[model samples]
Target: MKNSVKYAVTGALAGAANGFFGAGGGLFLVPLLAAWTKLEERKAFATSVAVILPLSAVSAIVYWFRGGLDFMTAWPYLIGGAIGGIIAGRVFQKVNMLWLRRVFGLLILYGGVRAVLLL
Candidate 1:
């Protein structure tokens, strides 16, 4: 029951973030899945990616229906992102978790700082 609630809340938050931001659900899910559900680091990261799929699909569909999606402009990014994802997945097991965490943290911090500065 507790686990279900945790998942439910996490899903809601992730879905909402994805729907609202077009991305970022995985960011929220990672910490929650790790801290709340006690998932291991790699497992949590993988789980976050897995969970993002459906949320992304739903968000994409809604955006498309609303005429907010521009696939032509997104194609290049999609291709590059796919390649990056493949490379990252292949290297995931080889990389040290501490280094991965550090890099991810830096990225999140950089993004946050940039967003704040932009405003």
Candidate 2:
């Protein structure tokens, strides 16, 4: 498939994942971008962030229209997330990709475990 088609399909899937899950498009996107497009790991990660930001905004707007979002409860997290994002962005280029991958994997594993156990 052409790169444009591949990217479109990947973006569709990521958007679906974000819309359905309220976030986590990057969880699907980062791996798909790295594997399917043969993008470098760090570039894949950065690209996922860029793509997800718009996907998330669209999703959030949809959720708000559907009365699924509570801005009052979300403000604290938004504030903290903004600060953390700034810090992460500033230091992102300096981080070791291997360790970043390890931490990402661990977080996914933890989330999976918690999800399964919660059920």
Candidate 3:
């Protein structure tokens, strides 16, 4: 497929999952990208991160302009997230993704439990 078609398909797939399951689809995305694209595991992951950055920034900008972002309140978490992202980026390549899948599964389970409880 052409880049445009690939992008459209990826965006559509990501959005479809987002609409149903929220951002946890990112975990789904990494593995799926690996499976779907010609990129290797590390390259696929990097590509996913590259794709996510602009999309997430645009999303945050939209929410911010729409009176959704609480910049002041979001600081502590954002700081921790940045630090964690750096650490994870360094270590993630060394870790086997079988373990990553297991960890992601736990997260999905946790989110499901939280959602059920909050309902």
* Number of the top-ranking candidate, with TM-score as the measure: 1
Greater lDDT among 2 and 3 belongs to 2
Give me the runs in candidate 1 sitting further than 4 Å from their true place: none
lDDT of 1: 0.91
On a 0 to 1 TM-score scale, where does candidate 1 land against the true structure? 0.94
lDDT of 3 by residue, 1-119 (tens): 57667657777676555544435446656776876665676676677776766666666676789887788988998899899989999998898977876886798799889989995
Cα lDDT of model 2 by residue, 24-63, tens digit: 7888899999998899999999999999999999999999
lDDT of each structure? 0.91, 0.93, 0.71
Give lDDT tens digits, candidate 1, residues 10-116: 99999998998788887789899999989998899999999998899899999999999999998999999999999998999898989988988998899789889
Residue pairs with backbone overlap in model 2: none
TM-score of each: 0.94, 0.91, 0.76
How displaced is residue 11 in candidate 2, in Å? 1.0
Model 2: lDDT to the true structure = 0.93
Off by over 4 Å in 3: 2-6, 15-22
Better of 2 and 3 by TM-score: 2
